[model samples]
Structures are given as structure tokens and as C-alpha cells.
Target: MFIPVEAPTAFQSFTLVMPAVAVGNVGQLAVDLIVSALNMQRVGYIHTDCLIPMIGSNPYATSAETAGELHTAAEVYMAAEMKLAVLQIRSPIIQSKSRKFRNLLVSWIKASEFSRTVVLSSSHGYQRDDQQLKGIPLRYLVTPALQVSGDTFKELGWIEMERTPPLPGLTDPSTEPRLSIPGGGITKGLFLDSCDAGLSLAVVLVFCSEGDNVPDAFTLVNSLNSWLHLVDNKGSQIWKIPTSWGLLFGSGIPPAIF
Candidate 1:
């Protein structure tokens, strides 16, 4: 269920952005950069039992004054002037309820009547095939409903995620290429759901690993910025790193350890 802090209708026709729980959590970190940099307002939250319940101090709080405000597992933030909305998911989905969660998201997206939806995600770098390893680490996918021309991506110098043969190095003609996103939690499912529903959805993701992924996050967000131009990047230090990110590696080591 989506519980609104303001009018639910405020989301209508807005472009929705969200992250998939995947390897390195790069998508979530990119979203953090967007929210902190834009100073978007909290609009609503999706209260679903499908995700593990969790809460903490505001991740984007800039000062002592705002530090104590609570934030939940999944919350919506909006930059109304830009007609953009972001859904940040901080907790993992319950394994048994993954399908349910995807369905819930699809339904909410449809009901909200969003102009389009963008999913940010990451996949395992080591799993890439020879072709996947040859180019830039970034890739994109757009559902048919978007009616996006291949020329659009070609002009942007972006590569579409390729479908690989189910069995690599196999000579059998019966085998067909298929879309695969190892470690991209729910990304494939949600995209397929959007496709079946004829929703305008696109997925932007990076190939990455599982440690010190901060740089990967920057790379992913920068790639997204190339397409969306969400912020002016001409200046130095444009994207603000949220205060919460400071503790990403955890509190300082104890003096006794030395």
C-alpha cells in the first residue's frame, strides 16, 4: 500500500525512478546522490509486507536540525519542478514474496499514471560473456511501450543489453538468445511485467562487483545524467554526497586497536 504524506494525485504524469536490489547496491547509492543533490521532498511511502521492515534516521539530512527525522524502508521523494519522482528502497525484499513485490510495484506504477518509469540496477561483472566484456560497462533496456527508436540510443552512443544464447558455445540451432541479468534482483521480472502491461519503462544498469562500489555508483549516475540531464554537471562537486554516506564503512576504529 502507498501511504501518502501529501496528495496521491501529485504523482500523476511524473517520471518515476527506482533502484533494484542488486550486486554492489550501486543503483541505491546513485539514487541517494540524486535525492541529496536535488533536495527532493518526501511525498509518500510504499508500506508493503513483501519487504523486510526497517527504519533509520534521514539518510539525506544535512544538519543536526534534520538528522533525527525518521525514514522507512521504501519512501517516495519528488522534485515537483522537474516533474520527477524517486522511490528509494533501503531493505531487501522477502525472498518468498519477490513476485508479490514486483506485482505491487507494477500496480502502483499503473495506477499512478506515471509518464514513464526508469529502473536503476547492477549486474555481476565477472559473469559477462566475451561480447559483454568488450565495451563500456553500461547498458540500457527499454520496453516496447516506450516506442523508443534504436536511433535514439545509437545517437547517445549507448548500447542495449544484449540477449545471449541460453547455452554458450553451443552449436544447436534450437537454442535461442535470452535476456539475462545475474544478480539484478527483480529487475528482469519487473521489466518483463512492464512489457506485458505495455508500460513505458526503461532500465539503466552497470556491470559491477561487490566491494567499495562508490565509484560504480558515480559511473552509473553519470551515465544516467547523460540521458536525463537531471543536474548541471559543468561545475565541480555538483552531486552532493549525503551525510549518511559518511558512515558507509561503519564508525571509526577504536583507539585500542592500534
Candidate 2:
């Protein structure tokens, strides 16, 4: 309801905590879009399998030339609450009996001095303008897991909204921003643009754990300057979607499949 008249100007590195499930690929998409928007360097990409104990499994985790690659990703994920945000994207079928497992996972992620976190799910391919969201603010848009049957982890409330797919005819920002990337391949990016109105607008993907579904709506604060609203074609909330990683070679051509 409150839209900014101008953009903000304070730039801060934001970490994105996403599920390590297939849906997590959604997270990659979201990050890629953000990197292009903000023109900032890609932080890091953490592959968290569980949160109860807060463990990161970079399956392909390897040493970088400067180690800054992995460090940046870890830093951003912890930026919200200085800890990791728990996402239930582990499996598509919530087993309904995984209540205990889910609790442990949430507790473990919370144990760490969490700065703040926002939990999101993957899209059902049902693209719409906007949807309704309800919940109290915690730190960074952390909310209840959607798409899950019944109310299992309702304790961790979250907001909801409509889904927004990537727009058509968008530009590829792998090198234009010209930051630095450690890991190669089709990596996604996150873009946080500060507007002149003391407000910030983030165009990012809602990366969820494997089974976690994309959230209908969520809120973001601490814009480079202030706060701003990012709407979709129907004037709904708009988030950055990671398209793909760059080749780092080959004329830096545009990707075929996003």
C-alpha cells in the first residue's frame, strides 16, 4: 500500500537462504536477476541440506582462488539474522509425518545468531497478478511454509502473494555489471537497486528448499536507501529471477534456455 516516490542509496550485501532441493534452482534464478539489477558482486551460494544443526554441503564445494567465492555466499545467507533461514524445500511431498524432522531443522537454523530470514517456496506455474498475504513481521519476511498440506509448521508465520514469472525480452547481465565470479557455469544473481526516494527495490527469486514452494508474497527492508515496492505485470510484488550463469568465455553470448 505504501509505495516510494523515489529510490534509496545505501547499498548493503544481502544473503539469500534457499532450500537445497530442486526448487532451489528457483533460488539460483532469483539471484541471477538480482545481480544484474543491483550491479553488485555475486555473494555466495550455500547448499544447505538441513538447518536444525545448520550445516552447509557445497557438494561441489571446492577452494576458490581467493576463497572469497564461498565466503560471500555464506555471508549473505547469514546477513538477515546473521544466521541461515530454514526452508522446507527438501522434498515435494511433506510426508505430513515429518513434523519432528521439520522442527529440528527449524530449531537448528534458529540456534545460530540469525540476523533475519525469509522462507519461500517454488512456483506452481500458476502465474497471477497478486495474492493476499498475512503474518506479523519478525526480522526478514520469515513466514509459514506454503503448499504444504494442513498446518504443520504454522508457528513460523509468513506472508503470501501471487507469483510473478520472468518478464519477456529482458537483458542478460553476466558481465555488464562486471563484478567478479568465482564459480563458473550458469550461475544466477541477485539485484538490489537503490532508488532516489530513499527506498530500495529488490528483484530476486524466491529460492526455497527442494520441495518448498515459492511464496505468494513477502516483504524486504533496508533498501540501499530506504524501501520500495516491486510489482509485477498486474501491479503485484516483483522479485528477481536467476536466469542462468555465464560462460566466462565464448563471446559471453546469451543463454539459450533460462
Candidate 3:
């Protein structure tokens, strides 16, 4: 359920952006960048039992005064001027409740009446097939309801995610190609659900590995910006890195160890 900090109705017709807990946490990291860059205001929380419980100080806190504010596993932020709302997921979903979580998200999105939704996600780079290996590591998928023109994507120079054929040995001529997103948690499922519900949704994802994926995050977000024009990328304008990312790798080495 959504517990609001302000009027829930404020989100009407807004575009919703969210992340999937995928490999290297690329999606989540990308979301952190957006929230930090926009300095979006907290609007609500998606309180549910489907995700593992988590709570901590605000990740995007600008100063000591705001640093202690309580933040939960899933929270919503908004930039009304941009008609954008972002849902940041901080914890993993309970394996057994994954489906429940997806259902909850779909129901809330429908109820909120968002103009469109974009999901950020990542898959294992090593899993890419021959065709996938040839171009840029990023890919996108749009539902029928979005009704986006292929010309739009073509103009943006974006590539659509491809459906791969069956493995060599299992190649039955009648067998169909399949859409696979290895390591993208709940992404494929959520996309399919949106398709079934006839919702306007699109997915933007990257192929990455399990490591320091900060660069991949920037790449994915910049690609989205090419389409959404979320922020001015011209001149010196750049995506601001969140302060919380300071210790992403770990603490400093102990002098005693030297």
C-alpha cells in the first residue's frame, strides 16, 4: 500500500520511473543518480511485506540536518515541474513473494494513473548472444500501449531488445525465439504484466557484470536522457553523483595493516 507524505493525487498523469534489482545493482545505482541529480522531493512510501525490510538514513541527504531522516526500502520521490515520479527500491524482494510484489506494483501504477512508466534494469554481459554482442550494450523495450513510433527510436539511435533463437542443439525450426533477460530481477515479468494490462510502459536496460558498475549506471541514464531530456547535458551540466556513494567499495585501509 502507498503511504503518502503529501496528496496522492499529485501524481496524476506523471511519468513513473523505477528500477529492478538486477546484476551489479546497475538499475538501483542509476535511480540513485536520478534522485540525486534532480533533488526530487519525497512523496510517499510503498509499504509492503513483499520486500525484505530495510531502513536507513536518507541516501540523498544534502547536509547533516537532513542526513538523519528515516528512509525505507521503497520510497517515492517527485519533481512536479517535470511531471516525473521515481520509485527507489533499496532492498531485495522476498523470493517467495516476488509475484506478489509485481502485482502490487501494477495495481498501484494503475490506481495512480501515471502517463507512462519506465523501468531501469540490467542483465549479465556474459549472457549476450551473437547478435547482442555486436552493438552498444544498452537495449530498450516498449509495450504496445505506449504506441511509440519506431521513427522516434530510430531518430534517437536506440536499439530495441532482441528475442534470441533457441540454443544450437535444441533448434527445432518450429521453435520460436524467446526474450530472455538473465540477471534482471522481475524486469521481464513486470514488462509482460504491463503488456497484459495494456499499460504504457517501457524498459531501459544495460548489459553488465558483477563489479563496480558505476560507469554502466551513467551510460544507462544518459541513454534515457537522450529520449526524455530529463536534464540539460550541454556545456558543463552533468549528472551529480550522490554523497552516499562515497564508500561504495568499502572503508579506507587500516594504517596498521601497512
Among these predicted structures, which one has the highest lDDT? 1
- RMSD of each candidate relative to the true structure: 1.2, 18.2, 1.3
TM-score per candidate, in order? Answer: 0.97, 0.30, 0.96
User: Mind giving the per-residue lDDT tens digits that candidate 3 earns over 137-201?
Assistant: 99999999997755988788778999988673456779998889999999999999999998999
Ranking by lDDT: 1, 3, 2
lDDT string, candidate 2, 27-107, tens digits: 333333333334333222323322122332221222443233222122222123322222223223233423333444344
- Residue-wise C-alpha lDDT for candidate 1, range 51-95, written one tens digit per residue: 999999989987898999999999999999999999999999998
lDDT of each: 0.92, 0.28, 0.91
TM-score leaderboard ranking: 1, 3, 2
lDDT of 1: 0.92
The alpha-carbon deviation from the true structure for residue 66 of candidate 2, after best TM-score superposition, in angstroms, is 4.0
Better of 1 and 2 by TM-score: 1
Q: lDDT of candidate 3?
A: 0.91
- Steric clashes per prediction: 0, 61, 0
